[model samples]
Target chain A: MADPFLSIQHVRKSFGATTVVQDFNLDVEPGEFVSFLGPSGCGKTTVLRMVAGFEEPSAGKIVVAGKDITRLKPNQRNVGMVFQAYALFPNLTVAQNIAFGLKVAGMPKADTDRRVAEMLDIIKLPQMGDRYPYQLSGGQQQRVALARAIAPKPKLLLLDEPLSALDAKVRVSLREEIRSIQKKLGITTIFVTHDQEEALSISDRIAVMYGGKAEQVGTPFEIYNRPATKFVANFVGTLNVLEGTVTDAASGKVKVSTQEVSLKGKLNGSKSGDTLSLALRPEAISLGRQPGRDSSLSGEISEVHFLGSVIRVRVGIGGNTVSLDTFNSPATPPPAVGEKAEISFSSGDMLVLH
Target chain B: MKSGRFWAWVVFVLGAAYFFIPLIATVEFSMRMRRGAYSFDAYQIVLGDPRFQATFMYSVIAAIFTIILGVLIVVPAAYWIRLRLPQLRPVVEFITLLPLVIPAIVIVFGYIRMYGSNSPLPFLGSDTGTNSLLVIGYATLALPYMYRAVDTGLRTIDVRTLTEAAQILGAGWGTIITRIILPNVLIAVLSGAFLTFAIVIGEFTMASLLNRPAFGPYLQNIGANRAYEPAALAIIAFVITWGCMSLIQILSRFAPRSSNRPN
Candidate 1:
């Protein structure tokens, strides 16, 4: 296997009584974009800060390119960081901002100017060099910040919610821009974000953290479809959990009981009558017109929400709400509120998780 | 509404006049050298005097020394105190405000006893032992105002960003402080320096207690020995202070509209 470009070994951080990060370990390959996905205060940013040398780890070591960089100061680490606030120098023009890192590294004036011009070209803001950060929009400022951070050509780029300051459209577009730029430069990047869609869209792998620990780390598809922990499953996307009990033990199959019917699930160890939770994705459950459906439980339609491209149908199953989504089709009529409906799904969709 | 604004302006002008009347009277009285003969003799004599020049130079040297050392010492202390040692902030801020709380004579007397000759420490050794000690004293006195400017400057910019950005660019603390921080806070430093200069020029108690040659002694000498010259000297000092302040105002206006220097 190729050597890991960045090795974070069992890093931990604590503030007084609370642990911000615990036993966090991740290895990023060269030219890979990995995302730390979590809600606020979940230590995703803390890990990024540690890698950037802004925060020191209480325990463990960080190695970059085979070098132990745990104790090195931020400036000594040869890493670029873009903050959520778009912390651009208001006193410097866009070109000067891009050249700040080069200047700090004592690059010659001619070379600095060349690199700055190249940075502007790469960020696609070549003509806006003379404008100050205050003169630009939020998206423009973020681009300048990105350019400034990447201009030094550091091996690792750490982005902390870099696109969060922009509006929705700009946020999406700039994140795309950032992803393209990362690919173009072939730089190993660690992006910290709370947005699940962004993490799923732009990363080679995502480490979903909870309670200061990485709950799961896998490719975006695996993370979304096969989360390892309940935290990861619930945090990464909307999930509907149903109360159930195992009713079989052999042949790697078990029956999960709801109120009116038993749902089939793949379980190898669980015996009959053992309490468990039935984890199901909203898109996995299919609603139909059949009554007392075959191997499918029936529920009353509680609410129908028109969500533009897809419609959300909330069904009351055994006094618990279970949501299912369908693509917005004029031919596919939504179930009326309080109407009886049967929800069915293939055995592959039923996740026997506790 | 416009008439109310006009009335408010009238009241403000009246209040301003009330404050400047005494200063104007003093200056006019100084000009009436011979009780009817409006002559330039007082200013000429004061200008020609070797003692006045010497005292003025002393004050200038003391002010320059204070500005340099104060910036050197306080900027880092305030920066670190504000950024890193946040818990020690209140105590550090209170220490800087010591001069404003205690009387000047009380503090200067303590200084003389502690640092003057015959004292156990001999910090200053003699009356004329070290003008450097007097500058330290001046910096101590100017701390409250000067530190405020630098502190405010540090606040306006993203201190963490500057440090992190500088570090990522291969800049150590020395480079970050001098090239990044110092230039960004130049206006604040200038404002502090101007205030220090004014305080040092008019500071009578410290210079007198120390028996040091400074502008305050010259003013005192003129006030006691010559009548008209004191008025002229006061006017000169006022003009110098006013000129320095106005220059700062213009420079502050010329400052970038952005709270932080963007790069």
Candidate 2:
């Protein structure tokens, strides 16, 4: 690939004795929408701030377009940032707030007005130019904030949990709008969010962070379907860990509870009689046997949850409980608790964890 | 609920009457200075007096200087404490409250003793020096109000993020403070400034001790000699105070309201 537009190499940050981020690295292509996905205090925001020049990295270099920006001040970095709280200049009207960067750069009045109008239209709030931030709703204010950040046409755009404060419906709609706007502008953007679904929906690639390090970085499909670590598998979606013992090391066979399943080299290198952890996605398992399903286990129904379209059923096999989801149909009643049921899935669907 | 609201109205009416009755009597007494019928003779006399003009003007000038000095000292101090030295907030707040705890006379006395003619910094040696000392004293008096107001304003807006945003927009420290921060906090600063003006204009203890030609000393002098003019001067002072407070109320309507709250 050509040289990355933004390169973060071996960046680390430590506050006193507590290390917040350690050996973080990422190279983002121009116009790529990359998301740093993690829980709070996992250093996603810290990395974003370092990129924006708010926090200096304790180690390593940040290169943009092949130029080093490690020691530059935030003002000199020419980066744009949209914060979680919608930090709009409260005193200025929406138009003036969007034009703040242009005005500060000493752009001519006619040009500044034109750019402000353009930004207002881009945010889809053209009629709100004269309104103060307080007059607009929370969603509107955040949209204005996005317009303000991008009005300067900075080299890089950073969004730090911008949609975390909005409602559910607004959050979904606004994220779609943000994705469309980013594609239209073709600006290199780094989004930091703790919401897994948000990261999955908007990012071209996601870096799932844990304990101040990127555990896995890949396209959303790769990260979700083929997680590289147990942490990634557990954090990204609903997972069920089934404890089993390797019954035949030579043939990679395992005994899960009362059922014997051929792993077919899924296990890393566990010998016979050794305990192994196998993860199965809830959606990968079905309540009854289906075509092409080679593995099956009998268990008693322990719990049943009616979740509208999908009914989630938990079953107890020997001493372990496994959860699976089945589509709800009015023609058939859901299995009741204390009833015998058999769960089936293809052996290839199981993941052997290290 | 009906009884509770009725009692609330009763308490409000009683409080209003308790406060407004004295003001009504003072106005009535000030207007009855010309003859058996009410007239503006006392107001005319007080307004026409050269002493009134000089002392009132002096106090107004002093109030302006006091406000400027207060802003210079308090805005930066408050901003720095909030941005860099947040751990020192309690210490700074306690120091600002010291003026309130220590009486104005005691502070003025200390100023005289430490800054006497023989001392290295002789603030009481010349008339200009004495005026500077007076303004400093007033600034000290207004510190508590100014700091609290500005601190509250800073609390409402995330100062660190705003500063970072402005910096990323290519604004220097000066622009960040003057254009970004100052405009955001202008309403708070004006609120504090008007309060300071109201406090400094009629201040009696410090001006009397400093031996400055302020309106407070003038009002006292007129009260000692003339009867009707003193009431007229009181009315004028009340009007000025009311004007300052009214301006504050009007300005508050224009203050940048927090958009975080739902409409």
Candidate 3:
């Protein structure tokens, strides 16, 4: 590896007494779209700001393109950032906003204009150059902010909950737009958001942060499917941790007994006599299905919710309510309330956590 | 402005009248040049007098200094308090409210005692000293009001987001303060400055104690000596203050809508 495009080496931040980020370390590859996903105050945004040089770490060094930027000022770092509020300069026109960094760096007027036009074209708002940011809608203003940040062709792009402020419909569209633009530019970008869907959809790799630490760092699929910790399992998606014990350990499967049921789940690294607690995702679990010649768990349809495309059915499993989501068009109709439904999921879908 | 709330509207209009009647009376008194004639001759006298000119000039200069200092102190203080030192808020707020607790006379008296003849650090040892001390006093008085304005501005915009964005965009502390933070808080700063100008210009207590040839003392002296001209001067002061405040409102109205935030 020539050098990690951007590397955070065990950075830590504390405000007076409380330590927000502790021993945070990650090496981001070039042209990779990475997201720092976590709940509020999980230090995801704090880490992003540290990378952008807005914050000085209490420990560790931030290296960008082989340069030691641990102590470099934010202005000295060639990073473009989009804020949650968009941070569009109200007094400046869209074009001027896009050209702000170039102008500040003392670029010629013609070149600045050209780069701004290129940015506008890329963000799909070429004609909005003369308009002020206030004249535009929320989505439009964010687009302008995006264009302005990327216009300078920064080495790294930092988006701190850029789409978190938009409405649901707009959030999806803008997030997609941001991903496409990142791909087009191939800028090593760090997107900080608590929205799991947004992170899973856009990021090539995600460092799921918890308690100011990277609980797990992997592809969205890995983080969601093969969660490494209990926190990761609970935080990643709607998970049902059916507390059970390993009654028997076969070749690749372990039969676990819960309070009201006994089911066999694949234990990747578990021995017999060990306590086994596995997570099954709501979407992965199948509901209202025929009993196959496989390990079956007892379930009852306690409640049913009809989402637009899927039916979210909560099943009573071993005195625990496990939500099972199934597609609702032709495959299966949404389960009725108080219906006797048998739920079964593949062993592969079950995540065995130590 | 919902229609069909006529009774509420009536009560609101009455409330507005109740507050504005005294102001109207003052203006009415200023309008009459002679005992019976309604004319702007009072304005002519007020505008024409060199003493009034000097007083207004001093007021403007003092206000400009106070505003600059107040904004300088409050803008970053708001951001720092919000982001870095949140625990220091109550202490800072309490210090800011000191002006409201201590009257202008008492504060100026302290200044005279502390900085007057043969003191440890004589602030009134020279005219320059007196002028600077007066401006500092005014700035301290305006601190609470300016702090509120800046605080409100910070609340409206996402300060953390904006500051980080500016930083990432190659803005140093100086640039961020000048280009980003200051522009965003311009409306609040302007409104505070205008209000401060109005207060300091008409204030009679501090300038009298300090013995500065500023506007407030000039207004007091004029009121005591000249009767008709004093009313005219009062009207002039009212119009100027009103005009400055109105200008602030209009400028804020025309200010770009800062959506720099989520929907």
Candidate 4:
């Protein structure tokens, strides 16, 4: 592809002897919303800060729009950032805070006012121009912070866990609002968050990070379904692992519990009698026998959880327990605990861990 | 709850009486200047005196200078310590508190010994130098209060993030300090300034030793010679200090509220 809008090439950061980010690299397209999703201390925020020019990379380059801005000052880089805590100027009114960059750049008063008003309208807080940051709620303050960051028409937008501090209901709605605003502005944005659902819901692409490295970078469906690494599979969604032994290396047949299932190219070259770990999503398994399910296993019901919409059931089979989710229905009662149960899943759903 | 509130009121009333009784007596005695009946003659005399105006205006000018010098010294020092040398905070705090720990008389004596006419600095050799020395002395006395106020203000706002924000907005160091940081801490610095003003107005030891015509020295000179005027001066001094404190209270109401949300 023709040069990506923002390219982070081999960026490495170290503090004293401990390296926080090692050889981190990514290419973001223009107007693309990419999320750096990882747990805390995974170097996701460190990478974001490097992009924003707050922290200098120990090695490598950050090029934006064909310009190498690795050494440029944060202001000169023209990147907007929303901090985890709303870093709104406490002394300035909402309008003044939004107009700070414009004022500093010597934009005319009329133009500055017009731009500030435009940003306020974009964040859906047009009437709050006269309010101080302290007077607004947490969500409102963050929205104002968003407005302030974008008022300067920055080249890139960086959000560092912007919604982590909000309530659950607000977090859901605000994430939607942020995605829509990012689309409307079409600003190349990088979001750093640990919430898997948040990343999957809003991002056009996600870079799942672990141990200061990007383990996988793909669309949400690809990251969740075809997780390249064991870490990605375990981190993105709920998973169940079953220990098995390969019966035939040539035919890729593995014996899981008392059931002998055909792996058929899922196993990555395991020899006969070698132990292999297999993984499956909780939703991939059914409570009872189903048509077209080529693989089946019998077990006893261990525990049942009524989760309102989906009932989670744990089944004990051959010294191993596998969890599966079945839809909760009033017409059909869930299987009782200690009842013998037969679970079935498609052979294609099994992921043989490398 | 009722008894708790009742006892609270009782304690408050007792404290108020204990504090205000002496002030009331001073005022009543000052008003007893003209005759058996109360009159404004003492106020009139004190206000009309040319010596009083000269010395009071001198002290006011000196207080203003002291405030400027204090801000120039303390604000940058506090900001630097916070930004660059955070490890030096305890050391800097100890140094700032030295003025409070070391008595004013001893410090002024040290200044005299070190900066005498025969010494290399020779701050006492001329009137202007001596006046400057007095302003410096007042600033030293006010250092503890001024530094603490500004340091507290810095704590409310994240100094590192604020600096980065300003820098990204294309603000130079000068603009950041003058427009951004200073304005954010203006209320804190003003409170400190008012306190410095109060301290300098009634400061007697430094001015007396330095041979300046400050308000404190003038008050003492009048007290030694006259009886009623001394009480009158005391009341006036109290009013001036009260005015400074009232100004601080009003300014605090206008300070920028910290945006930290309640948990």
The sequence of per-residue lDDT tens digits that candidate 3 reaches over residues B39-144 is 8877788788887788788878888888888888888888789766879989998998999999998998889888886998988999888989988999888888
User: In terms of DockQ, which candidate is strongest?
Assistant: 2
Worst 10 residues of 4 chain A by lDDT: A262-271
Where's the lowest-lDDT run of ten residues in candidate 1 chain A? A252-261
Listed in order, each prediction's TM-score against the native is 0.93, 0.93, 0.82, 0.94
Off by over 4 Å in 1: A249-265, A289-295, A331-333, B1-10, B34-41, B116-129, B256-263
> Residue-wise lDDT of candidate 4 within A1-354, one digit each (tens)?
778999999999999999999999899999999999999999999999898888999999999999999999887888888888877777889999899888988999999999999999998999999998889988998898888888888899999999999999989989999999999999999999999999999999999999999999999999999898989998999999999999998888888887888988876667899998889898899988999888888999999999999898999989779999998889999889999999999989988777
For model 2, the interface Cα RMSD in angstroms equals 1.7
Stretches of candidate 3 exceeding 4 Å from the true structure: A15-19, A237-245, A250-253, A256-271, A279-350, B1-50, B54-83, B112-129, B260-263
- Model 2 chain A lowest lDDT segment of ten: A261-270
Which candidate model has the greater DockQ, 1 or 3? Answer: 1
What is the lDDT of every predicted structure here? 0.84, 0.91, 0.82, 0.90
Task: Please state the error at residue B185 of candidate 4 in Å.
Answer: 3.0
DockQ of each: 0.50, 0.61, 0.44, 0.51
- Model 4 bad stretches (over 4 Å): B1-14, B113-126, B261-263
For every model in order, the TM-score on chain A comes to 0.94, 0.98, 0.91, 0.98
Tens-digit lDDT string for candidate 2 (B1-263)? 99999999999999999999998998999999878899889999999999889999999999999999998888888888899899999999999999989999899999999999999999899999999999999999999999999898788787887888788888888888898788878889998999899998899888998899899999999999987888888889999989998998898777776676322
Between candidates 3 and 4, the DockQ winner = 4
Q: Which 10 consecutive residues of model 3 chain A have the lowest summed lDDT?
A: A254-263
